[model samples]
Target chain A: MAELIFTEDPEDPRLDDFRDLSTADRRPDRPGGRGLVIAEGTVVVERMLASRYPVRALLGVERRVRDLDLSGVDAPAYVTSAETMASVVGFHLNRGVLAVADRPAPPVVSEIIAGAQVLAVLEGVGDHENLGSIFRNASALGVDGVLLGPGCSDPLYRRSVRVSMGHVLRVPFAPLDGWPEGLNLLRESGFTVAALTPRPGSVPLRGLREKVGERVALMLGAEGPGLTAEAITAADLAVRIEMVAGVDSLNVATAAAVAFHEVAATR
Target chain B: MAELIFTEDPEDPRLDDFRDLSTADRRPDRPGGRGLVIAEGTVVVERMLASRYPVRALLGVERRVRDLDLSGVDAPAYVTSAETMASVVGFHLNRGVLAVADRPAPPVVSEIIAGAQVLAVLEGVGDHENLGSIFRNASALGVDGVLLGPGCSDPLYRRSVRVSMGHVLRVPFAPLDGWPEGLNLLRESGFTVAALTPRPGSVPLRGLREKVGERVALMLGAEGPGLTAEAITAADLAVRIEMVAGVDSLNVATAAAVAFHEVAATR
Candidate 1:
């Protein structure tokens, strides 16, 4: 069972993992970055506890800690006053509870691809919120896995985790090592690599389900600057959502959902 | 042509519509509310200019104003320094331009229904960003109009306008007056009134396109408390996006896109 330790001091050294969280939990390669996987609120904390990531500790008000089913949790949970919790975290988190976990090594890219019927391949989706939303959409739509290409942000980023409603913790993701050339690997594995773009000559997403064979990979890019030319060329075919002329393309995550519904939902 | 007038003072009475914007332009029914339509940044401001709403004035840096093709604009465009604009708006204006328009009387709900092949009917979707995203998706996926039901926030609120990328100015929407009973009006007008919910006995969205006949109205509610029992019962049929079991439902906007792409994209 998880250990419940009551503490009143805000500056305790044992609580360092929970201090100044806005900066402390940034990408580990950056300065002052511990790279801890931080989960906020009851739902996300529960998700972190269930994920493969190792739990380091938890910080929350007494009531919040008590509400959680900590019988299976092995880490120490520090219960403190809300005011002290806010002071230590450098922000007033109304969610009232937080969990920090150590990120395990990411799964091999090929392994994620091997087990998937449908995959969402992302390029240049650097916005944290968009990255998170993609995961949430991927999970709901039955996309088996996500493959992050170059320029994609970390799905485990705090903002991404919050925006994804903690689905980022649930979905399996791995970084594809090669760039546009890596797309060839999908074709060799009997997957149809379909790049999503608005450029002329792209097939309308309608009826696309019938055209692609069994396995499908929906490749998408950032919103404004869509999939690069080389990426499109590497794909077996290009697909696009029919839209009103002169209107901007749909947000990448929204576009992914539409594509997922069309090609991946049934599989 | 828009008259470009230079202004140096931050407290000019002419700028009152843009003052303390975070609170000033709330729904007119609220206390201290003027309920003016506000558009931020060059793109949204340009959309406001082309919209039916009467443009009151514009406050922007000189360079941004110069970049706009203001050949037919009738309003006076006020050119101001960023510092003065910040003081007037109560925050930094990073988008570099702003436009305020008077809210014209909304179109009758019947007119929007009469014209649209596909319509999105919303209930209790009060979050501005989600509301804005729904509009953006509706426009891109060929949803003809939107019918607002009870508990919905004003889509013309500043944040919704910004997040919609000004698509809110283009898409026609009107309030549905008679609650669940008002849904009967849609059935009379040839809309299927398919309520989107995950409850048991709901049809899978996968082939819903074939079952709904010609016109379709996708009724959606807020993210957490989805369509009410009364609302779902009023619909001709309950439909749901096929989702992975044990996963949370898709965000209302994302779900709307999936439905729109299925039923409306072709039409």
Candidate 2:
């Protein structure tokens, strides 16, 4: 069971990891200066404990700490008043609990794709909330894993973790190093890389299921700019979700869910 | 063509329709104390001009106003400095433009369902962002209309309009007055009202296409407490998007997109 230490000082050095979290994006403790994998609220903290990331410590109000099932938790859980906790964190967090975890080395791209039926390959998805929503959608819709292409944000960022409702901790993701050129690896491994774009001549997403075989990789780019010419050209085929004329395309995460349901849900 | 009137004062009476938008939710000019339909950004503002809602006025930076094709717009366009616009709206709006419109009487529920082949029936989806996202997804995925059941929020809320990318104005929606019992109206109109739930014995969303006929009304509830037992029991059939066990359910809007792609996109 985790040890519950009572702390009243807002400036305690023991609570350094929990300080000024509003600016946590630039924490030096994280990989490449991106913040630690911080999980807020009981549900996400519990998810972090279950994940491969190594948990360091926890800070929470008494009621929130008491509500957690810490039988398997090994970290020191600090119990503090909400006011003290808020002062320490630099803002009032309605979730009341937070856990920070060390970033584990990501799996190799091949490892994530091995034996997987479906995968989501994202490029230029730089928004943390969108990245988090994609992870949540990927997990719920049965996408086997996610591959980060060029310009993708870290899914372990604090905001991403919170937005994903902890699903980011559960989903496996790895970086695909070679950008558009790296897509050939999926092709070599028997996966059809389908780029989602609105360009004419692309197949509608609804008809895609009938054409693809055992393995499929759905490549998506950020909204507005969409997939680059090089990325779209490198894919095995291009597909689009038919939409009303003049309307903006659906948000990236929502589009991914539609594709995941059509391509991965039952597989 | 719309006339552009320059305004330097933040308190100009002509700009009242666009003032204090953060608290605009309770504007007296709106029907029943709800705010007017507000569209932010050039795209959304253009959509508002094209919508059935009667435009009251527009406030925008000179560059943004000049970019709009206001050939058919008859409302006064108030061009102002970003600082003045910020002072009036109570915050800095990066979108650079705003348009407000009076809420027209909603079309009868029967009117929205009359010619629609696919529709969305919502219950307890009170989150403004979620409601907006659902509208955006509904427009993108070809869901023809939306019917709000009990516990649903106003889709015309400012946040909803912005998050939806103004698609809420494009999608027709009306309240289904009699709650779960009112769902029979869709049945009478030759539609299969399929409730989306995770209950056992529910048909998988993938196979649902084969089971349902031409017309389908997808019934969805909010995220946590999904469709009540009564709501699920009232449907012609219950269906679920297949998901990994022990993972959280997809966000209500994302799930709706998945279901919409499965049942409505092709139709």
lDDT tens digits, residue span A1-267, model 2: 899999999989999988899898796655587777789999999999888889999999999999998899889999999999999999999999999988889887888888588999999999999999999989887888899999999888888998999998888999998988988889888999999999999999986889998999999999889899999999999999987776788899989988888898878
> Can you write out model 1's per-residue Cα lDDT over A1-267, one digit (the tens) per residue?
999999989999889888887886465674445378889999889888888889999999999999999998999999999999999999999999999988788888888889889999999999999999999999888898899889999888888998888888888998887898887778888999999999999999888889989999999999899999988998999998998887889999999999998998867
Q: Write the per-residue lDDT of candidate 1 for residues B1-267, one digit (tens) a residue.
A: 999999989989888888898896555674446478999998898888888889989889999989888898898899999999999999998999999888887899889988988899999999999999999888888899999999999899888999999989989999999999999888998989999999999999888888977899999999999999999999999998889888888988888888888888868
The Cα local distance difference test for each model comes to 0.89, 0.91
**Window of ten residues with lowest summed lDDT in model 1 chain A:** A25-34
Badly placed stretches (over 4 Å) of model 2 are A29-31
Model 2 chain B worst lDDT window (10 residues) = B27-36
Clashes per model (N, Cα, C within 3 A) = 0, 0
True contacts kept of 1: 0.92
Global lDDT for candidate 1?
A: 0.89
